[model samples]
Target: MSDNRRIAEEIIKAVGGKENISSIAHCATRLRIMVEDKENINQPAIEEIDKVKGAFYNSGQYQVILGTGTVNRIYEEVEKLGIEGMSKSDQSKEAAKNGNLLQRSIRSLGDVFVPIIPVLVATGLFMGLRGLVMQEQILALFGLTLADISDNFILFTQILTDTAFIFLPALVAWSAFRVFGGTPIIGLVLGLMLVSPSLPNAWGAAVGDVEPINFFGFIPVVGYQGSVLPAFIAGIIGAKLERQIRKRVPEALDLIVTPFLTLLVMSFLSLFIIGPLFKSVEEYILQGTLFVLGLPLGLGGLLIGFFHQIIVITGVHQIFNLLEIQLLDKFGNNPFNAIITAAIAAQGGAALAVGVKTKSKKLKALALPSSLSAFLGITEPAIFGVNLRYGKPFLMGLIGGAVGGFTASLLGLKATGMAITVIPGTLLYLNGQILPYLLVNMIAIGVAFTLTWLFGYSDKEKKM
Candidate 1:
């Protein structure tokens, strides 16, 4: 048998064979497979396979890191093994059926947020850049003050930094429609209409800066800028309404009638009913989450820091996107980002310890890359493939994360925005708090690394 075939066979066997896998896909560096039974998979044997970087179960998927081109080659080989292939859409649909309530919720949230993270990440980088340029220290290096920057340049930065949050409702709407089996373009248009310039902006209405237009003296409708729940709820409603309308409308009038009713009914309902109701609901949730973050003496930070990755494992961490967005919109900065970064840095630290201490060359190669990926802001590889695989290391990383979170809270460090972390996260702290951010990261990494190396793995396991 060819070497590639052997590797493919090992992957197939490790993941509980052909009957157990529902779907498989590959990204840049990992093979993502949804297995029918996670418990049936043999993890250690998979890790022992030559050229297999690492293996871990996360977010209801069995992800195997094989590194770049090597992953593609093995994926092709797996395809030839006569296992039925499936698309990501299939996996998503299957997600609802395969797991418990928490898993399904996390998977659904992940489905909605993962598509949007790229745009958010890009915008967050710019927010960081804008802060960097506005910092007094950095301004000294440029021999300028905030006033020294031209009006046009400042306007451009404002537009760049603000555009994403302002239109976030549209993105969420578009994504939610895709997830729920609706026509995506219509959802995009629906999102656009939600934030139409003619309506009062959501934030302005909340703070009493803009009054909502009376809809026949009964309803107060506003644009949903910087909002998540309203758009998400609206999207679900719109998608289901569109699908149902399409089924009942005559074939000839289907396009016109279906869209017309979908928009007229759903958009009005969203504006008059769902949007306002959910907005009130989100306000309460926002208050609750902020209450947690505001607990005295860093207690909030310690709890969140220690448990964020545990939430990540369950795929429910994306739920925090709502609270993070709320904080950013209202307060102009996010301390929550600072706390979460600590958790991520600790995961990286723990992963690095495994890489350095492992006697297996394959694990050594895998650990370092995964650790670097975590440091650069993606923690799946580190959290699943390394830290969590070694149970002690995972807990150690959480301890380090808790310490780092406490440190951040005590120092009152906060990020200029949300969604960026670790090295990319550094950009968010450029407003004179960069030193504190770096220090928190060092403490997280150092503590996690020391504890994980000392306690996470034994010499025998390292040799294995």
Candidate 2:
């Protein structure tokens, strides 16, 4: 039998047979199954299957991390076994019903922000590329000075790097509205109002280049260009209000009246109350994060790096999106990126050690690919399929993260962007940061690999 077919059959048996599954679906990298009873499934057996990266119960679904192409193929094989497959939307609804308040909240935040990360990643790459060409050293190599650069070309580069952040509220608001079941277009309009040209820009107002417009003599308002919390709050409020208004208005008037009242009332409340209040709250959050990251001797990085993947396992790592947004919004440099990349790289290193030391060809196959995925900044496979399963490698990976994080902090490493980390993350460290970025990753991977090879893996424990 083909590997995927055999793996699929093994999975059904491991999860307590096909009778225990309520529904199944596949995302980009996982097979999400809603089981009839969690207690019935053997998670260890599932994780031990060849090509199965990891298995865990999350939200309301038992997710098997099977990598990208493998998941689609395995899922197809699963379908051939007579188990029904659900749509992604249906799967989301099923999973949504399972998490507690905190899980749901974090998941909602993740849902809202995750869609927007690609834009930011692309923008960061653009920023790095722009910075690269603008450097005096790079320009000197071309025998051209900064003044020789065309103003039009410079303006175009600014458009690429600045557009996403300049309209970030719109993206956040739109995403939030979609997640909260509101009209996304209305949310987009609302977000645009927050950054309207009539108001003084937030950056300009902060630097005192322009004064904020005051309402009722005390309430001050400015354009929210690089804001997060306010936009998200506005989206939720707007969506809720729209839903409430829709229920009250007559069908004939609903089309016109619902949007009108939603916009009118929400605009005032958002600008006067929500925007101002949450902006301060966001600032406080930003300050608190800075305090943690700024701890003496990189202790902050050490702590976060060590615990980062642990947080990922608990499924609350989405909350870090807020901190990262705050960092990018305030300082334009994200130290968190550097620290987390080290943490992620260490997992890959540890997994690689397992691949090297194991005599079992089945394990070698799983370990090598899983390690590659971790290096690309996706760590579920490495963490679940290899390191965590082996016990000692997971701890070794954490220690590697701590040491690498300290080096990053001591050397003052930061990235031009967020989201992308490890290898593709190199884009964020361009311009002048290439060497230190490489050094930090190498050290992290090196430490984890050495430690795991020496102490984490054992051929005696290999079952295959």
Candidate 3:
């Protein structure tokens, strides 16, 4: 048998045979495998493979890491085994059953961005703390005034945050290409054009006051920067194009000619067809959100506020970026800022509940600091370990979040900037109605705390 076929068979056997795998996909450096029985797969044997780095499971996916370029090749080989229709629980029927609403929501959240969240959170926290330091003149001892420090910090933070968005096309291209078993460099080049700063400026200026840019005598092309879906579509197209090009190009000129043709065609399609189509959809979604938020503050705020924690738990809360970005760009402020404050408060409430209810000193120690961290908008530890474990605390937090959100909306509180660290940052929103916002926040926390205490602990029941 051929070497590629042999490799595929080896992988199939290592993963508990072709019967054990339900489905498979690949990421930048890992094979995302869905197995019928996770226990059936021999992780150590898989890791021992020359191309494999390690293996682990998260978000209901069995992941096998393979250094750099191996993922694409392995993914391609696996696809030929005709295992595409296998269910995630085909091997172990019990595994495929759905979890509860909260469990499913949390799992979905982790699945969507768990691979990318560490960098996103770290970058966010860095920006928030950096702003505080500059605002407080904490770096003045280094001969830097507040203005100077702020400028420098803002520049650095912008670069870091923007990198992910700006080069998002490239990241998606690389990941998708590897997943589909194609040359990533060709996909990367195609992605680069979509995010190219010069292209957006040029396109924007060209279409100024007339209409959006048109491509190839008919198709409309939109400028893509900091967009998610368009780049993903483009990457998929680019990978397919690369596969075709590789087959047709001569061995001697394949390196140079294949990439050139793939990039040229993919870039054209991305800019002219894919990018503009997605942009229009994004604009429509934003308009829909505005209409929804325009409802009466009591119902609108309560619903939005109540579901906000649920959204965060699902990790699709980043969808809120559309509202925040639009408001920031047009109005220089956003009212949705109060929603985030409530989210932080909910985590704090839940953590406090866990701390008070748990009898184990070790658990209390962990919960205490976790509560403080949640108060500062760092809620993973509390959410994953405490609130989730104790269940009632999380529900109480949502109730608190809804009440707080409603009060803030009623007061028409607006945030001047996006700051994860809330207590001190709340001052930034203190234009005229400072007291109302403060009162709203305090009330929200109080409600959350009371609910947590009541639901999380029973006077008649012994503490754990």
Candidate 4:
């Protein structure tokens, strides 16, 4: 057998063979398998597998950290072994179907956000690049001003950069439909209707540069171009409405009538009711977040730093994603981005210390790569696979993050972008403010490292 098959077989055996697995899924860096019994898992054996970095249980899955670019192959091998695989959405749906209300809500929330993270990551990179190209020094090196750039090229870059936020409703609607067990194409059409070019753009509306159109000559209406909550609520309405329609419509005419009715009904309700209601809610949330973060003496950063990773562990950190975007939209910068960066770096620091302090080859292999990944802005491997697996290291990382966050908050460190952190995060600070950003991160890393090295691990916990 090829190596991947062998590894897949070994994984199955270690997790109590094929019989014990209830379902399987994979994300960017881990194999998330649900098992019938945790007691049947051979943790030591799984840890010994070549190329398997580490294993841990979280969010009800037996997750094996496989690093970026490597997880897909293992997931495929596992699939070929005749075990059915599920999408993250499907997995969330199955697990949350019978869960408590809170569990279902959290799963639904994750469904709306996790699938879109890659786009946000790309947006963060663009923000970084935009900062670099527009800097006075960088422009001087190129013998140009911000205005010296060609207007057509500038518009092209603007389109490329803002398209995601411009029609963000469409993406959310599409994902949310699938999550809620409805036809996704209908969701796509509804999303497009919400952000049609005929309507005023969200940014223009925000700046009062465009007037709202009166719907049916009475209620005011505007496009939901950059709105999340509106699209999310609309998706729920559309999905439920479509499901109900599908039940009554004949299959012969189902394809023809169902989508038409779903879109026609949702568009009117969204433009007049749900969209307006949710937009107001989002505004209140934005104001509340701003007030909290603007508190004196860095309290916001300190608390967020100490607990952000815990939020990540529970998969609810995406709510802050909405806050970050709103902060960037209403203001010009995101202070929360830098604070979150410190939080992630602390986890990396703790993991690095664990790697250095460990005697076992398995723990060494797990911690080192995970720490490196954390520095690059992906912390699941380090957080779930390492620091969180050993509870003390997780707490130590939190302390380090709290200190770093407090420092950044006190210094009023801000980023030109959102959603990227750690190494790639440096890109967000390239505009004449690189030094202080670097200093803030360094302090965070140093504190976390010192604390982790001092208290996060011991030889006794190194058995893998």
Candidate 5:
């Protein structure tokens, strides 16, 4: 209809149009297309388009990397082409759909989760700073002791950190409603139902005794405070119901009557059907995950750790937060802590290797300091400067991380608590068996450093 819309139509046609596209998703900078056949898509034609940055086929998807602020508009255009059925074209989609109700219920949980990360990071850092201040000897110099500052800071950060989660249903409800193009108020009401104080607790005794509450002597709704998927489900239902009611209502009374009926009906449906069902599924997923993690810890650790960095790159690492939170709730700790630890170490290790191997003084200088930053768990410098530049270092780092993860898993090392600072965070895992994990950390670094050095260096450098 317009230039942007025309461009989207043209791009869709270039990618073999509606028939060829099996599914499509867009990240901040890339359009990921799953096509029925790669041969059907016209690559050069799409790339030749003014806004299209680049195109590549990898990991069984056709990726069109775009400039900033272009992805959403492109995605909307693709949706207008009636491509919603594309995701179901994949064979795995059915299995993914059937595996668990909660799995199907929270369709785009990652999408809902990712936008909140900056908030999480900010609050975590604030909390960490508060802890650091309390440990400072200068507290007394300011006429304050550890006790004076600790309570206030702790409460402040806890409120900030927990607000999103405590009212998780409301957040998910709002996000889901927005996604479905419904009223935020409708979504908010649905979310409140899930996390309402009157709702029954379904996480059982291990979760500190929750009593099942009955509404009207029939409908059973569970407490969903700090829970993710159930509220999302409720929100979707509420939005859909709202859409339907809006269409049926008379123009004169549509505003008030539509919302009133939508909220009332949706709330009842969520309580009777969606809330309890998703809560059960969430609990099952938690148990299944823990069971998997308990198996040959080394192999589990290796797979999980090796993919941690790669997962972060794709912006889906937040999906793992559900796992981490479940673990913390159940066992007071998590095994995948080492996965993140090793991923950060691998970046550092690779950067160090690059610093030593590269001939360019500028490159070396950048690599060395970037490597140090990686040790602090800041990965952008290492990812862009070292990994993307050298390439080999990234692969080496993956291998080393897998090795380290395996070792930590074998020793049954687990994080006692979460830490934002990588170096000091390692101490979170401290116990009688800390040495084994430390050794594993060292070995991973060693392997990455040695491999990168041997493979990354040029012949001239060796001869010199």
Candidate 6:
């Protein structure tokens, strides 16, 4: 039999055979199986299977870590064994049913933010590259200066770096509307209205360059460029309103009245109530984040880095999506990215140590690749497959993360983007920030690796 087929069969047996499985699905790195009864599965036997990095119970599924490309192959083989599977959409619904209110909310937030991340990442890269070429030192090296660049060229660069954030509300609202079961096109139009060209820009109004429009000589109004809460709130309210309207309107009128009423009512609500109220809320949140990150002696960064990975294990770290966007919108730099990169790097380092120190060839194979994945900015494999499996290694990783975070804050390190970290994260720091960025990651990896090698790992664990 082929290796994938054998592995698939072994996984089936370990999970208590086809009879115990209700459904199966594969993500980028995991084979998620919904089992009829968790008690019937042999967890140890699954861990011992060759090429199986690790396995864990999460939300309501038994997720087996089988690496990137391997997961699809193994999943296909598993299906060929007579057990049917579900689509990723079905899998999400099943998983959603299992989490608590908070977990589900966070997961929903993640789902909304995920689709917009690539655009933001691209904008960040554009900003980084622009900053790099425009630097005094770099330009001087090329016998050029900032004034030497054409005005049109600079305008083009600004367009690339600024367009995503300028329309971020539209993207967020569209995604939120879709997630909340509303008409996404209506959401898009509502978001656009928030930042309509006729209104005074939020930033300009803030700096007194443009005066806000007074609706009734008191209620101030301005474009919501770079605002998040207002768009998100508007999206949710609009979606719920549309759903309610759909239920009431006759079938013939539903098509016309539903969207018209939803947009008309939501537009007024967004500009008059949700926009102003949530703008303050967003500011307060930003202030709170700044206060924490501004704590003395890098303590804030230390705490965040130390706890970030732990939070990931619980599956609620998507809350950072809001904070990072707020930071980038306000300060144009994200210190949070620098700190979390350290936490992620430490996980890889610990896994790498495990891979090197273990005498068991089985473990060595899993550990090395899992660590590589973590360094590339995905940590589930490293955290679940290697470091977390060995108690001491995870502790060592936390310490490494804490120290790295401290150093990052001390140096005031930041990134141009979110979503990517560690190896791919370098692109976000290329605007004269590469040296300190590399320092933070290297220290994190060094500390975690040294600690794990010297004290965290033991060949004796092979016997266990």
lDDT scores in order: 0.84, 0.90, 0.63, 0.84, 0.67, 0.90
Better of 3 and 5 by lDDT: 5
- What's the distance in Å from true for residue 164, model 4? 1.7
Please list all clashing residue pairs in model 1, or write none if there are none: none
Where does candidate 4 stray beyond 4 Å? 1-3, 43-54, 58-60, 214-218, 460-464
**Cα lDDT tens digits for candidate 3, 14-85:** 889878887787655567777788889886576445444346665466767553366678777788877673
TM-scores for the candidates: 0.90, 0.94, 0.60, 0.92, 0.63, 0.94
Question: Per-residue alpha-carbon lDDT of model 4 for 304-348, expressed as tens digits?
Answer: 889999988776676787788777656757899888899999889
When summed lDDT is taken over every stretch of 10 residues in candidate 3, the lowest stretch is 87-96
Report the Cα RMSD per candidate.
Answer: 2.8, 2.1, 10.8, 2.4, 8.5, 2.1
Error of 2 at 140 (Å): 2.8
Clashing pairs in 2: none
Q: Compared with the true structure, what per-residue lDDT tens digits does model 6 show for residues 1-464?
A: 99999999999999999999999998778999999899999999998887788899878889999888999999999999998999764666678888899998888787778788889989888878888888899999989988899999999998998898999899999988987889899999999999999999988998999999999888899999999999998998899999999999999998899989999999999999999999999999999999989999999989988999999999899889899999998888899999999999999999999998888877888899999999999898899888888888999999999999999999999888788899999998988999999999999999999999999999886433
Cα displacement (Å) at residue 55, model 5? 7.6
Colliding residue pairs in candidate 3: 36-91, 36-92, 109-314
For every model in order, what is the number of clashing pairs?
Answer: 0, 0, 3, 0, 0, 0
Q: How accurate is candidate 3 locally (lDDT)?
A: 0.63
- Model 2 reaches what TM-score against the true structure? 0.94
lDDT of 4: 0.84
How far off is residue 371 in model 4, in Å? 1.1
Against the true structure, candidate 3 reaches a TM-score of 0.60
Number of clashes found in candidate 6? 0
User: Which residue pairs in candidate 4 collide?
Assistant: none
